[model samples]
Target: MQRRLADNITSDHLSCPICRDTLKDPKLLPCDHSICFECLTQLIESSRRFNKFSCPVDRREITASSYTLSAEQWASSFPTDELSLLLLQTISGDTKTETKLKDGILCSDHPQNGCDFFCFGCYKIICSECAVENHRDTECNCKNFKNCADLAREKLRDAYDEIENLIITGQDIVFKEIDKDQLLLQSRQQIRSTIKKLKTIVQDFEKMINRKCVDILSKVDSVTNVEELKKRTEGIVKDLKRVRDEVELSKSLTSTKDILTVLSKIPESLQKNTDLLYSLAVSDNPIELKLELNEKFLNLCETLIDQPIGTVHVVPADTIDFEDTEATVCSKRIKFSSDVLPLRALELDPFLAIQLDPSESENKITARFTGVIIHGHSIIAIDNANFKVQRFRDTIENQFIDEVLIQGIYDITNIHENDDVLVTSPGKQSRLIRLSTYNSLSIISEKVTENAYFSISQLPDCTFAVISHSSPTSSKKRVNFDWSRGVTSHIDIIDVDGNVLKHFSENFLCEPNEFGDPFIMPLKSICCLPNGNIVVSIETKTNSFISCFNQNARVKWTYDLNDTPEGVCFDDGKIYVFLRESKAVRVLSVDGDLKPVSTLRLPNYFGDGYSLFVGRNLLSVIDRTELIRLYKLQSC
Candidate 1:
């Protein structure tokens, strides 16, 4: 009968409201419900933005007024449910000595009496006399001290076990990180060795070409006498000059005998000159002596000059196929796979337009999506004008999934490994907010910045490339807008902790005034490719351009745009740039020197293609007209 009663209590009262399992270390909430401590911590963390959480059972909201406390402390600040603990102990058959230990704890206020009950209202262990004198008429709930102590012991034991498990997890993570470091070191060594070999081949080729050039010149010099030919030509020129002088002297004579003598000598002089010319022409002419190279040798040299001495290929570690041995370099054999779709070959399919205007918003602002990303089958966008982050299904109906309120949200980017997202809010309170999308849309944490961040992209190393822009008016009050005022823009590489690792400030063609200050162009958008190359769009007063930077923040190339560029994203190996004024998307190849591959003209209804996202076979664009258009991409 006792066991049956215990089973009924466990079934009715012992289950957690969140996990629906038997509550372990259950905490009592203000709404008179119990939940597992872990569930409560997650709730607090997820709702830290508002410093409040909704009870999973009753849907009642609980606010934590002490915002300085961490999530763990907030969860731990709740009182443990002594009654639930007592019931759990009763079910576990661990309450045999409860009666004997009922009087073990002495009351602090009433020193002569042993503590018998735990006062719920006062949160103190008290004797029967003290409970009657202080808490009895005050509506304080009381429980047996021995049962409460037993339950508290069990809770402590569970907490100890949790800590032990966490320690083991930490150790495992450390070991894995060490292994990764070793692999990185090995990879660096291999790269250095390969580069050294390539340099040696180039140096040897240079020496071989020098030796071949010397041999060809030596053979040509041994075959002819340049000095003797020059002497023979000079003697022939002297004889011709003498014959012309004699003819001129004879023509000046005023007698027939003198003319006849000059004419008789003319034939002898002409015959002698002609005979000398014929003899020289019959001999070996130096100009006619050509260097005839071996056909096979010339062909081999041309082939070597046209082809690359060696190629250094970099690929993702996961994509490397070590077993493929068809091509080996530096004792490493890798099989290359081509999975990137060609942008020029992509054909646009039927598109769907999804309305982004929220029905319940009180402000009637046009929806302006400044950032967008496609995660899984959902399209997430930042509604800049509406101050919200909205998610929707990528289908014909375009069903709304969820939306979270974020003030002054400017851009959104994905954290690929976990599907979480980072958003920038560069308004009165500039910050970078991270949101988790595992089970629901919830703010994980936020990092405040000194300046307003406009665009953000996640780097290959898991850091972030963010563009921060600060205008003079933003710092000081201005009665009117000044176009000549200098603005500052920086592309900052930041880690997960929001620490700036590196920053780059690009120089534009702006003349300094008397104060020697140059106006900085505003960076509009940024995107990071898989190979750690960063593409940033900058807008000057008259022109706009997109610059590609390598991992070290060195500019690789810059491509000029005909119109203002609003957003940029890398899909496969092509860079997709959205032009706001031209209403077009320009696709450029990363490996082809940033050459324009194709231009996708947006329809008139797209209305200023502000932001775009490209997936495996889908392209999503969000415009300023409160709509998100989805287009299916197919290989032609």
Candidate 2:
């Protein structure tokens, strides 16, 4: 009833390496071969033993970042025999209108497994024989591979569609956010412009008011003096009164005749003065006006800055402390109080968050450990993956620029403000390497009894206490089946130029070296109190412990933690220790007390718990894979 596809086929299938199981998320290596995720992890785990893990197909060296898969399709949705044959026929030749052939193809490589191997990209084939020759390797990531051409095209097409939609959404939101600010600014500008115009109008009114007054004053002054003005008014009034009295009496009287003559002259003079004043007043056209401004303008401006970004309210405080029962010391937990308030609300626009490789942000520093040296507009990471210093432009969009060309070192373990980088390259030769921004790589000239991994603590300028685990060149004391082990089994103190600052060798450490990833604890992992003492996490194979030593390297106290203390760091005024075997991270107080764990969520990190680092309020935990997990401290 069902027809098989790959049974009598040529090409179009691959095999699995680990369980010989159907390779679902097949990743091709640089060797033109493919392996499953499980097989890849096994290869990485076996690196220390082999030192070189290569693809079985072409024998090219495999690194962690180079695995590739055309599509993320799962193996569970495989096609059946008859359906797979029909699908294969349609994919190979032309469309098959047969309704019976729709179930899809059964993978010939693992025909019994019933998984299909027809890659949406390669169009070629891969049987279930993986860990042998799969194509998802890093080299196959680019376009134009015959086998994965179709898949790449389809995936790229879909990615573009999503990115386009995101960009459109983001642009729209950004436009609105910008408009919000612009609207406020524009309103303020308009009010100021209107006020300026009003001031001009008020000045005109003042000019008119003053000009009218000046005209009246000029007419008064024309009379020569205040006494003259009084005399004229009296003369006119007297003349009018004499005429009226003479008229009431006999008209033939001599006084009446004299009053008539004075009256005529009085009217003339009065008319002349009145006409002059009226004409001057007409020309001046004065109108008194009072300055007034809209009271609401100022109030509107005062509220713009503290306004909410979106639906969220942002009331800024210089510092915030948690109000939780389990709150750690000095921890200020910033919770997502509500989705309505966004810290970066303006970023809510449909921006295409094309998650590019974050490694693309920070270039690989060539030295062992590099410190952030903020110079100009660039933040230089000195210890690049190679022996070259990689520089990143200090901006939201970090861009890589020129690098310092060097050789023989890939990282700086610890960097200080003094531009000093501590490099660790203890393959066969053991040396304290120091690289400065100005000078090249230089090795410390101090000699110890045994050459092993060393970590140092700086006490003062050019003076430090070195912690080493080497036991007196002990050919006399033989290492049994169980002995102290760690990359930095020994510790020492050195200056910026790699000189032995001070030697603090103590016999206080856990024995039978079961500890791993020693250098994970930074220099801050150990410190001295005001009593002139020191506390440090000593690298021990069986039981890693934090040891306190006096100034003379005399072991004073040791806190035996019941976990494989692989990586440790200090934060929130306390020491946080990571246990590899138990998969639990503990926060220890400076006084050798463990606190409760509240916010570390790492699940897929299957490791010996060896890598950890603290940044701002979040802890970055790495399982030595391509993926990194960030555990944020919860706020009270």
Candidate 3:
């Protein structure tokens, strides 16, 4: 009877009421029912808003005394089902013992005893007699077979818990991927439908043209037939009139010889007219009718056929793979040297020089580039003269691609992570514009600011650092006056919504002169570093310099330059400063006193460098002469 009852213990008896799976980490509920720990935690989280959860088996509501406990804690509050765990272990051990006993696994030294205990150090099973003799040492670390088995089972349970967590995370990722796939499929279907409609339109246009051609040809044929009939009738009437006049003249003569001559001539003339009429009736010659089409219209049609109706712009996928171990090892092994490395002069080979196309501008004004940036494989520039933003191919030819009109734009900067750009328009109502460059140049959002921002730069934390210059007063005469006399500028750190987070006004490149009056330099272009430092170019009548400021707006360091600085940008741990008078770019180290590294010289004919953009292996500069020059960095 006991054997039959043991055999009748089915999987349903061991299964949890919530999951219907064999009990694993089973917990006892208040209603005397058991559930899987993970399942209970999920249920508790689902009912957290109500502060009560109903049991799956009895549908009884259970409320926690305090809502401060997390879902895992609430699940853990329930006691573990020790009886189920014990029964599971017993069943597992019984099966293994039966197999070993049937196989007669006895110790070699003590053949009469069955091997039960396991010696961890010796890695072998032993009988009781052998355990007392060989595995008696404390270092052996021997334990009973049942205890060792239970410990192994606990480790397996921990591994299974980790696997369950992974399964949940993987399911979420798969669902997201499926959603993306559906969107792509929908887009493809839309494109196909659009193409089909375009094809139908073209076919209809062709049919209309064919109908017009047929109508024209039919009109031409009718005109040719009428003109031929009119010419033949006119010739016959003229011949008959001549013969009748001869007969009338002969009858008035009143002489036999005259009458005979007139009658003979009349027969000859009648025969001649008859012959002419016969020839006209029998003639099968076709009139040479040519239908001439307009040359310009035909050429236009050919051009339209040759060109594409729409463009397909392919955006690159944004994905990055990184290894944590490799990065950690590299960080530990690589150390930057304290000593300043030798300056490496990079040769700037002239790649291409593109003159701005005058026909592209609506106002027919000279191109005046105010800002320029390298986005992906194209060079984008703002033409202040025409209020246009133009894009050019970043190849050797540097061909013009397209342009969009944006009024009052002062500066532009690219956001690398997404193919978007931030543009600043400084005026009475200054605004910051965000544009999406994925499909085409289009405005996404705009934020109005209280202060007029001359230049804008993106920080590492995704905020913006903008510079606002105070307009000069008419009372000021001298160009290189002190701060109290000349115009000053301030920097404001603003979030995406155009709300100013931090403002710095007082300590911006301020130094006292011999008379104890502070000298404030006028700020020009600005850029941000990876470490959140703000660098701004300061231009003065005598000389120019670039200053680096920390997060608190305090000047960290300043590097003096010989010529006036116009534009500034940072790339690869270095600062590039464009000098207007010198018409060259100066590279400075971002560390250790901001020392000068090297100078990249431009052509003598190149105009004053207004803006500069650096790419991975290319450098572009726009000048005041309506020319954009590209250069290849030899050893970048």
What's the CA RMSD for each of the models? 30.3, 29.6, 26.2
Name model 2 segments beyond 4 Å from true. 1-419, 427-433, 436-488, 510-535, 538-542, 591-599, 621-636
| Model 1 ranges off by over 4 Å | 1-347, 357-359, 362-365, 472-486, 508-520, 580-582
Ten contiguous residues with the weakest lDDT in model 3: 321-330
Q: What TM-score goes with each of the models?
A: 0.42, 0.32, 0.43
lDDT of 3: 0.71
Q: What lDDT does the true structure give each of the candidates?
A: 0.72, 0.45, 0.71
Better of 2 and 3 by lDDT: 3
Task: For candidate 3, list the clashing residue pairs, or say none.
Answer: none
lDDT accuracy of residue 115 in candidate 2 = 30
lDDT of 1 by residue, 1-636 (tens): 757865666766788877878999999998778889998898888866677788887888888878798889998999898767655664575554255346476567856445657776666787654554577544676777645677667757888999999999999999877766665666778788988998898799889989999988887776546586678777888898998998899878999998898788888888988788676653543355676778998899899889976666655543322121122222234343321212222246656667745565678677877788887777788888988888887774658889899898988888868778999998787888999887668899998887667788889898999888766564553233233666667788887657788877655223245756444466667889888878887666555767677767556665555557777888888888887665667776767444455666544444666567878677777665577777776431
- Score residue 292 of candidate 1 by CA lDDT: 74
1-636: candidate 2 lDDT, tens digit per residue: 123443322233444555465453556555545566556656555542334466655667643322332122221122222322333443344443233225544445544332334444454444332212364454433222224457767888998999999999999999877866664565567568877887898689779868977977786566445476467666656766665565565446577666676556656666765665454433334344343545785576478557753352233321222222221122232222111111112111111111125344356322233223333444444342344445554443336566654443322344535555454332234445555544333343323223443334344344444443343344634232123342123345655545654455333332223543333222224433434455566443233666655666565555555545555555555555566555656554554433332323244446544445543555544442333344444431
Model 3, range 1-636, lDDT digits (tens) per residue? 634533344264557776777888988887767788999999888866667899988899989878788889999999886545544544455665456555857778866456667776777777654665577576675556656787657756887999999998999999868755764565578689999999999999989999998999888876646578778879898889988888878868968988997787777788888888776554566656777898998999999989988986543222211112110111132222221111112347888777767775567788887778889877788777777777887774648777777777878887758798888877456788788777678888888776777678889998989887665654423233345566668899987667899998835455555756455565778889998989888765454667777887667666556567777888887888787765667776766444455677664445666667776766777765577787876542
Candidate ordering by lDDT (highest first): 1, 3, 2
